[model samples]
Target: MSNYCIDIFEFGRHKTQEVTIGDVKMGASNPIVVQSMTTTNTNETEETVAQIKTIIDAGGQMVRMTTQGQREAKNLEHIKAQLVKEGYNQPLVADIHYNPNAANIAALHIEKVRINPGNFVDGAKKFENIDYTNESYLEELEQVKKKLIPLLNICKQNKTAIRIGTNHGSLSDRIMSRYGDTPQGMVEACMEFLRICKDEKFFNIVLSIKASNARIMVHTVRLLVQKMNEEDMYFPLHLGVTEAGEGEDGRIRSAVGIGTLLMDGIGDTIRVSLTENPEKEIPVANQIIDYINTKEGHDAIKKVDTDNYSPFKYTRHQTNAVKNIGGNNVPVVIGNNHFTKDSDYSYIADSSVIVSADKKEYPVVKYSNSNEFDFNNHELCFVKIAYSDMDDSAIQFFKQQNNVVILLTSNNSNSTIEQRAAFLHLRNHHVTTPVVIHKLYDSVFDANTQIQASCDIGPLFIDGFGDGIFIENNTENQSLVINTMFAVLQASRVRFSRPDYISCPGCGRTLFGLQDTTVLVKEKTAHLKGLKIAVMGCIVNGPGEMADADYGYVGSGPGKVTLYHQREVVKKNINQEDAIGELVALIKENGDWVEPS
Candidate 1:
């Protein structure tokens, strides 16, 4: 219930007001819960029930299913009955959008109901910009209250908890008109519904503000927590990064967003939205939760003055730029190369390379295992210090050089903590030389490599630690290694090199073929470096969820699309067949189009 964010060094979980859904208790002193959603059509009771069973059996503490309309809402009864018959009593959540009636019916059979405030009452298709006076807005609130009362009564009668979830991609036109699609808008959107719940004396509620962009997600959740504190409301928070794509990109994106908040002691329950089978998401969620809960040395790291930092916002810490490592330059990516007689330096082009001392490289940073390395090449030399090597002598050596960047390494199981503690030691000792975070993996950088690296290194970046990232692995594919490094940088918002698509993972509410449309959009626009294009599933969160995207292609209706320049709708209801072409044309018109090489 405290307003202050958790101290990164304290390792304390924030205690929230407990909300019970069935036998599952979340928030308060409960172990952080893991949850996932089924991708099958909710109306197909058999398919949904089977998926839910898989999710629960795969270690999901709770399972969610989309309930978009009357039929899906009604089918919840059958899903619950089948689940019970199969001896699975895990709590079920109904994910509702654009329909209060569905929520009303879902509450009767499910343990909890999730309503997107953006479209629960306001239709997603009606996206006209509205000029509202204070009086007019109050009138609109009155209408919303009327529409929500039936669902509220049903939830109260059934003892069902509710999550007044707000998606960054989806905000009502009124909220957009007033708040201009910001974190502020996201907080206010949830507050409007929370106010209604309070008026009805319904207190069993959770809150979430999700965004595809991790930076926005972190900012919004912090703001929501602060706002809730101001209002004396203590609701548990449900955290996730929506539409995090498949594979390593999805996992890293989800972890950077969700893990950042978890490190701050902010979430009660979490779901990692990977575009894979619902069951695939559970283990990743579990890994993140287990890592955070068991992560040691938060208390061991010496705390530095945070007067210059705000937990609710991001401002890159100012440090003297050492060559290409820091200062106003975007953070650099250092590719790890084994020092060998026949080592290929071709992959090291355009990137600062890390090589061992025996290699005798001039342009590359010479990595030495001991502190006895020559510091004469201060600008290009990096000394590798294991956690065991961290002592008064090592600290003094690093402090004395003042120009050689420190390459901190660890072989301990909790390497992230050890590596971070080294950084804390440097900062605390006022050793301002730039530091490149290095994590060595014994195996190849494959499918699981990104997850491990992100978990180990992403948090350090989120907390404003590294100057460059050096990943050491045996993966022969240089492009994959380089791309993954940059991806982590982009996901952390420390650097940007490619187009960031804020594409939503398709759901029942998706109006168009989300997967195909996202592919088409990427093909045409992925060359526009650093430009963010949101390929949303539907209009519900399309405009709002685009967050700070440079352009948007959101599904408006069946085979219909709406294109946006920034957050403003420039083209509405275009045929899906031509939407991509038109989006490209619009980009060309705006001078953002670049010919793909």
Candidate 2:
């Protein structure tokens, strides 16, 4: 509950009531499930079934499809029939928005229904800030309860599990009026609906609170778990970074958010929402879960007081400035012999290292706990310590140092747990010496390794632990290691070296080709760093979902696009062919455009 997992310093899954969804049962100590969703139209049985097959074949444990209307909801029956005929028994979840009837119909046909509480009973968000006193608010809650009771009744009758998903950017006006569009609002939105389900004795429920910002997503999920536990309600959580985009950006972002929670033992299932083939997402999901599961029976780590930490928001571990490496400085990336080779992770370190080290500007020196520590005078003193060495005595010594930069590392099988425990110990003792997280990966170079590296260190940074990161990967591709370091930093909200795209994986409601449009948007906007851009498939959740993005490109119709500067609509209904150009023009008009070198 305090920037932690079930066991904090060790490993254990969070406990929750079991829920049945057709062939798939989730929560409690059940295996962390991997899931994917189709991009095909719901009514297209052949294609939808085809994608679901691909997803399942790729180790997807469950599949979800968009059901926007009654027609599509009815079509699910046919899709389920086709899958059954073909001997596919995996549960099919229907993603419903603003459609209780669709939820009712899909409940009759599918195994689960995912409804966004923001839109379900509140209807489409008018973006209004409604004035409500206690009486009015209570009246609104009664109306919402009445509206949702019927859906819960149907789901209970059909044995269809319901996921009351709350997206941060898309909170209902009623909730926003009171909670002000924050994580609390997202939780309240879902809790309001969940109370209805509980009152109706419908316990077949899972919950998801998501955000495009990895930090917000992790924070909200952690807060949600605490809130539910306070009420003695333990609903299973479905983990995802909603609208996480394609390729490396998407992978890093998803790993940062989803992997952090999985490490905390909070999620029951996950979907790496990438704007690619549904099958392609399954491997990423599998890789993330695999890396996290490796720490399940890990070696014990020494526990420390966590009253200094909060999982819901980030406040960098307090430290005094040591030149450019700590205390208000952006996280620094240190070079190692392996990753800093022909093309090192440093600032051209081969030549730069000699000059910088010779000048005594700042230097990295490995410290041994067995020997009495030596503090020599230099412009800045950088000392490294293994996690095992950061005991009470070492922390007391480092606490008084104004020029110490601690390099923290771990060799345990459960590297993150050990390192996290060490950080907590240091924080509890009020040791503010800047800490740079260091991890060595001797594993093969693959998606699993790439994702594992991020997951191992990501949670520390997200929990506001480290000041810098030092990485070493035993891969011939040094650039891959370099990219991962920056990716972890960016994904942790510690730094940004590339523009972030809050692009959603297109659903059946998507109007045009989503993948290609995302590529085009990235191609034109790659040079525009420090900007958050979203390429959403439709207006349904586009504008609201990418709420933090500096610019948004949302699909308004078939081959038509809408552009936004922040949340304000700058232009609408531009042809898809010219949408990219218009977006650049819009960026230039707003002074965010920059030419690629």
Query: Using TM-score as the measure, which candidate wins?
Result: 2
Query: Worst 10-residue stretch by lDDT in candidate 1?
Result: 338-347
List per-prediction Cα lDDT, in the order shown: 0.77, 0.83
Using alpha carbons, what is the TM-score of model 2?
Answer: 0.95
Q: Write model 1 residue lDDT over 444-533, tens digit each, in one string.
A: 777566666677777677767778777776666756666777788888878878887777666666677776677777777778988888
Query: How well is each residue in 1-597 modelled by candidate 2, as lDDT tens digits?
Result: 453346778778899899988988799878888899999999899999999999998999899999999999999999999999999999999999888889889989999999998888778777888898999999988888877888888887788889898988678888988998788888888888888887888899999998888898998898888888877799999999989899987898899999999888889999999999889998898889888888878877877777777778888888777776678888877655443422212422243221122233355566664245455555566677877787667877787677777878888878888888887788788787888888887777666777988789888889888887777664677677777888888888888878988899999999999999899889888888779999999877887876778999999888999999998998889999998999888989988877887
In model 2, which regions exceed 4 Å deviation?
Answer: 1-5, 338-363, 369-374
Per-model clash counts, in order, read 4, 1
Q: For candidate 1, give the lDDT of residue 209.
A: 91
